[model samples]
Target: MNSVRTIFQDGGIYIALYAYLALAMIVESIYDNEAFSRWTARAGMIVIVLLIGFRWNTGTDWMPYLRVFYTTDSSSDYDSVVFGIDQGYVLLNRIVFYFSDNYSVFLILDASIAVGAVYVFIEKSTRLPNMGVYLFYTSYAVTHFMGSNRRMLAIGFVCMGFLFLSKERRIWEGWPRWAVPFGIAATVHRTSLAGLAGLMVSRRAWPAWAVIIGLLACLGLGMAGLPFSGLEWLGGTLAQYTGISAIDKLVFYTSGEAELGTDVNVALQAALGVAKRSSVLVIFIAYMRFGNPSQYAQRLYNIYIIGCAVYFAMVGSPIFQIISTYYSIVEIVLIPIIFAEIPKLKVPYILYLLVVPLLLLLTALIPYLELYVPYRSIFSTF
Candidate 1:
């Protein structure tokens, strides 16, 4: 009892979220029935809601975006002007923000996205434990932070996009319809365009070597530090074609980072960012050793892993954390699917399920430890 108390006192909301998710995962693992699994899922949802509500009254990073949404005049000229680039997300936030100035709406949207993602996971990989899916949703860093809210929505859209790709077996469709949701998601956050690229890679009917080379090229760009000097030429070409400066602006946006100052913490984050990029190398090697995964899964995982590697190598920015965020989405679905394929490894299945989520929780906590520490006492106060 005292040990449990100590854990809570030390970790605060961090431990609370982890414990709730861990418990739910254990229960889902033990009970495979849909009804019971869903009950546990609802309980997890309630916990997320309660946590969001508690955090709402206190300030958090999401407050500013929520305020922008809630307080901004829909009829004002600035609404379209300020949000012209990422109109989809801005429009959604407007509707959500209309309800309240609190950031709870963001939490609600995140939870909804999580639930949708889990449903997609179950549909694609039915053998996965419900708790494991929920654990992945809760423990991932992207879901917890407000700064990446747009990316979170993009992840939700990615889930839907994956669902469409998975359904290709039934439909005689090529890529056009399938590409739309992902494109929309990309519009929500340009970072997600990588996911759409992944979808395209999955649908390719080419030989495996091509895929291998493509993955290598992505990694090489990171390691080689691909120059953007060509951006000026590319921007001019786009300007001639589109008659709009949007593409040029995007080029300039990414290019502008080169001149920005760096700090110790940012430098540390960059180093860790590189370490995280190495996970793509790990995933690629794992893919080669394990043999080709399912077409749809291959696309999602490869795209996600390559994006993480390439983005980190190029920018060395913490924004690359967005890859880790949604990659956990892929992990939840992929881990269980991979476990299902190896019946000979039955004895280790449960252990893998438990250990992987715990590892993800630890990785997610690295960035939050500083903020989480001062608030440890707050948990006891509750």
Candidate 2:
């Protein structure tokens, strides 16, 4: 255990996990057997839950959430959640504490919900579940499932809700289906409302050129800080009258009191975001226009493109990225689908494997490695 802890402290655990995912991708690609693909996906999901769920002291919020767990009890009032955390999350703490005050259990429950929902969606919706889970793990393991517990839970519900939106056609069937999950998500994190972008893009299929032009325009808007400059004042005014703690929290962040991650070189991040998002967008849109894309992929792709627009448009806002994340999470499954459908040629496949890790390195690790590296699991310490 001490040796394992040392390895984690050296960041070898992350390297190993990345290698494991790469290996799984290789096997699934080569074996061409249903059982191997299914089991490989299952193994990957279990690894994600265990690694992230049992993380002892990691990232920024470990001690704060631990403190919350320690203080919470069955009688804890949801309305009085500290710092205006959602009632749904406070209730979750109460329920967990009712059975056991062990914080590890709470963490595991969170990992189950956050990781499980996305993986289940991938499994149910995509032909390449292994690749889908790989994308989810690589993209968000540190930033989300390891950091913001409530936001992750909310994202879980949104991911599941998308399943309904992507599949159902009837207004009566689809709206209610997604709304139930969306309601649950909003209770956990108000930003989960960003999931509505999925519904918005679902209304009509815009032309390829239109979305591209719109995205570029949003980039310009963000550069000038048009909407966000007013957003702070607007958020403050709404918080005063509405008395919704969520709005208050939003006001706090946007007011420059707490960055919660908005403090950065906006222009650089936005440009890098363009490189990352546009790469995926090009692949997805190409398939939509030139190839035979399934209705599910088409709808989800539209949502993802809107998510990119949202992110570009709100690059300078404090909490806007959180909103954009709910919309962009669609890519976990979308990218894998696009990858799986690539022509059976070695060059494209090899380039994909090379490009994905490079992209993650550029967009995620370069920016976030220090915050969440030296991955420390409770079990490792033992």
Candidate 3:
């Protein structure tokens, strides 16, 4: 309890940003006008993008990223294999560097790619765009916008491809829409190739029983501190064949360096990790099965089931958790669909609201207050 209170006290501005978004989501539920909702989503998206873009010397990895961006030039292609940076990301830095030497401009461009694409997915595909955006900030904003900038770009593009999958068009047509985007995402970060699982989920929701059983199995396996020797071998093999340095990171993260491996009270942390994911999957899947959510929401829930299964099973492995991150993003859009249908401030609605603070509380106990508190921007003293 003291730790959680300390997190809120230290991260007042950071938590307040979340509070602001939450308030907007609540207010948005009161409006029925499509035009107003559309414009409000746009306005919120723009604000989020700018907030991420304008950061100066903020975020956990900004300094490292800034160093790499400055050095990334046309001559940096061969460095990609050595530094574990992706070739496409190198090219992006080189292109942006040549056009403008300012790192702030590069930051803005990266923010546009990462944060902007998810916003696009929510606005076009979800029933409650504001709720989706707010949900995104709870965990994703700090992780993606503030760190893992390269993988975030890949996730963003993959999300764009999911947009095509969510459409009512022929299934074959969806393949064509994604090939280019998925390829581009792979070039940015190879781990995103795991996102292919999304293509396999049918538009129909999976059976409620199957999802429940699968998640329970995952929870048990994850809590056991499952090892990943085969995964380490696979990463080594991929790096050998592809000559990509970044793929080697997979091996490092899984070689007994996962949080569960290093931390004391591993069982407690492991339980919390799986519990947070299970809460959403169990609760959201219940609503998805019983409620009249749109076809798009069902599709998102289906992918989430797959993501959660992997996430829960790999709670002890950080590399595999990356795959789950790709899948779990569907919640930003899927949860909003359910939230929009429930009566305002009713039991169901309040249950949905409970989901938002779960991740925030989890983060508060770990890296959030330490890394992202006292937010700053290039344009201000903060």
Candidate 4:
């Protein structure tokens, strides 16, 4: 039993993860019954534990705070400001770090987020237990990026915010209440403020002319060859208001290497850039063909998808990558909804199931393989 625990703790355990993912995929593909799905969901929980166990060696990004909490007389001012001192996580770490202050906690957190996300996807998706869906959630895009602990918390909260907005009873009354959680997330990670924008877009009704004017203005600004200067000025303004010099450092200047990182190929990146424009195109068509969504929920989803598309196209910077990632959270909800609603060709459905995961995996691998040399041993570490 001790030897079994030791083996599982070692990097050799990732092979078990690979096997688990493969088996889970097969099981999901073969069974569609409620009882079977529930069983698979439980198996998914087990896989989550294994995956977390594999991450045991990978250090938590927030471990320094845990050390400060225990060892130092300092009053956790740093923790308060940075959200490194949240009650739930701090207490969780206190207990876990007592045993082993290694990477185990991070793994647990990552696994929890992945499991929660998968559970949500499964609940929402109309398609029966399919290998593609499981594979999609397990892929690097969701598992590595979206499931990264702190970011995942922000994402999970944002997803909850979306859920609140989507609920029929809560739609009218939820906005005021939703701000609190959104604000908490923004405090933890300012990037989460994007979710607030998402909330606003989701809730409000905009005039058709107003949306068109906004698009034209964005395009005009992009076309005027002044976006860089505009971004710099905006950064400076933000820095002055916030008194954080880092704001001016902005991702564009600091993340040039990351923007040009190897994770995204020139061709695929170009394609993504092109696809960004499709939001405007989608909105225009959706407007012309089906008309605007009648409910606040559908309207919000449409606006978010379109807004992200345009934003990605206009700014192909690393900062926007974070924004793009958050936007894709909405896509997780939207894609399955669309697949269920649209009477598309069967081949397109099959192709979408196959190609999307392949594309996401390639996107995730390129960056991990090319830009992040230090973390390359992530696989080996597991």
Top model by lDDT, which number?
Answer: 2
lDDT of 2 by residue, 1-382 (tens): 4433443566676767777877787777666787787788889888988887777877667766776677644435523436677778877887998898788898888888888887778887877777777777777765677768888888888988888866647556557778988899998887788677677565445679999899889988887888787787787778766566667776877777875443346567666666778777777777788776777787888888878888888876635765788878888887777767775654576467656653563345344455556666776653
Q: Which is the better candidate, 1 or 3, if ranked by lDDT?
A: 3
lDDT of each: 0.53, 0.73, 0.72, 0.48
Ranked by lDDT, the better of candidates 1 and 2 is 2
TM-score, predicted candidate 4 vs. hidden true structure: 0.64
Ranking by lDDT: 2, 3, 1, 4
Q: What C-alpha lDDT does candidate 4 achieve relative to the native structure?
A: 0.48
Clashes of 1: 0
What tens digits encode model 3's per-residue C-alpha lDDT throughout 1-382? 5556765776565566677677777777777667767677667677777877887777666766777787644455536433777779878888998899998898889888888788888888765777777778776777666667788888888898788766676657757687777888898888888888787788788888888887888767765755355566776667555544556566556555434313234445456656667777766877776788777778888888888888777776655666777888888887777776766435557545656564654453354344555556786664
Candidate 1 similarity to native, TM-score = 0.69
Error of 3 at 322 (Å): 2.2
Candidate 3 contains a number of clashing pairs equal to 1
Which number leads on TM-score? 2
Give residue 87's lDDT in candidate 3 (0 to 100).
78
Rank by TM-score (best first) = 2, 3, 1, 4
Model 1 C-alpha lDDT per residue in residues 105-219, reported as the tens digit of each score:
5556655664555455554554545544454544453234323556656776666666665655533375555577677777677666666554555453334466457646755
